[model samples]
Target: MLSEPEVAKHCAALLEHFADYCEQMDEATRGYVVRLAWELIGDQMDRPSVRRTRRGH
Candidate 1:
């Protein structure tokens, strides 16, 4: 299992890579991808660790 710091580091890297990928996509595709990403992220925010982190526990 990853610690919060490790997860944060990986998420940062992934966001940077995702941004680069979106830059190469057309507007419509980028919008779709961003929406999907947010949906997935919102879903993940329900996990225990994520909820704890969000609440600053």
Candidate 2:
């Protein structure tokens, strides 16, 4: 089994790819991509960390 840190790293990489996909996608597609990203991260990471806004604003 992968360690927590390894899973976090993989999630981060997937988030980056999702960001890239969002940039190139239409509005509807971007929204879907973002939702998929949120679901993936939520499943893999701690609830508190995953729930925080990305910008920390």
Candidate 3:
């Protein structure tokens, strides 16, 4: 399992790449790119540790 900071860093990197792809992609291809990103992030977030937040006082 990744630590919180590592997960955040990876998410940022994924967003950066997604933004770059979105810029270069044509309108028709943009949806595919967005869907691909959504799937990737969704998969990561589905992990148990990442899905739950610590309880607050």
Candidate 4:
């Protein structure tokens, strides 16, 4: 399995790339992209995190 720090580094790089791509999108497209990303992230969250997200924490 990947080490935790390695995973974090890769995630950071991915976020950078995603941010750049999103910057090129129009407001509506960017909103959709963000919402889709949120849903995908929610799917991976543990129960407590999911609850906090649902509560808008």
Candidate 5:
């Protein structure tokens, strides 16, 4: 399992490489790609780390 710091480091690198990739794509495609990338990353980050139990036993 990766720690949060490791995830951040890899995500930073992924965004950097993604930027380079988007630059080489056609202008019409770059916008969609960037939006999709952000959506996916945002979803990943927004997910809860664990499922919570109810207050009652």
Candidate 6:
């Protein structure tokens, strides 16, 4: 398994990539991407942090 810091770094990159991919799509496609992202984010909002602990939560 990756160390906590390493996993966080990778997830950050992936989130960036997801945003970039959405931006590059046509308006119709972008809507789908945005909706999917929102769904995933909403599903996790109340869950404990999956990333490393820091000075702030």
lDDT leader: 2
Q: Clash totals for all models, in order?
A: 0, 0, 0, 0, 0, 0
**Model 5 lDDT on a 0 to 1 scale:** 0.67
Error of 1 at 35 (Å): 3.0
Off by over 4 Å in 6: 1-12, 43-57
- Once superposed on the true structure, which residue ranges of model 3 sit more than 4 Å away at CA? 1-8, 43-57
Q: For residues 7-49, write the lDDT of model 1, one tens digit per residue.
A: 7688667767889888789999887766656654554433566
In order, the Cα lDDT scores of the candidates are 0.66, 0.69, 0.68, 0.64, 0.67, 0.62
Q: TM-scores, in order shown? A: 0.44, 0.53, 0.41, 0.43, 0.47, 0.43
Q: Which residues of candidate 4, in runs, are more than 4 Å off?
A: 1-16, 43-57
Residue 26, candidate 1: C-alpha displacement in angstroms? 3.7
Q: Can you rank all candidates by TM-score, best first?
A: 2, 5, 1, 6, 4, 3
Residues 4-42, model 4: lDDT tens digits: 777757766766777889878899988776665565444
lDDT of 3 by residue, 1-57 (tens): 234788868977977887977878898788676656666555543456755456989
lDDT for model 3, on a 0 to 1 scale?
Answer: 0.68
* Residue pair clashes in candidate 3: none
- The weakest ten consecutive residues by lDDT in model 2 span 44-53
Ordered from best to worst lDDT, the candidate numbers read 2, 3, 5, 1, 4, 6
Q: Which stretches in model 2 have alpha-carbon errors above 4 Å? A: 1-3, 43-57
- Please, what are the lDDT tens digits per residue for candidate 6 over residues 1-57? 234777757756766887878767899987676555555445432345654334965
Clashing pairs in 1: none
Compared with the true structure, the alpha-carbon lDDT of candidate 2 equals 0.69
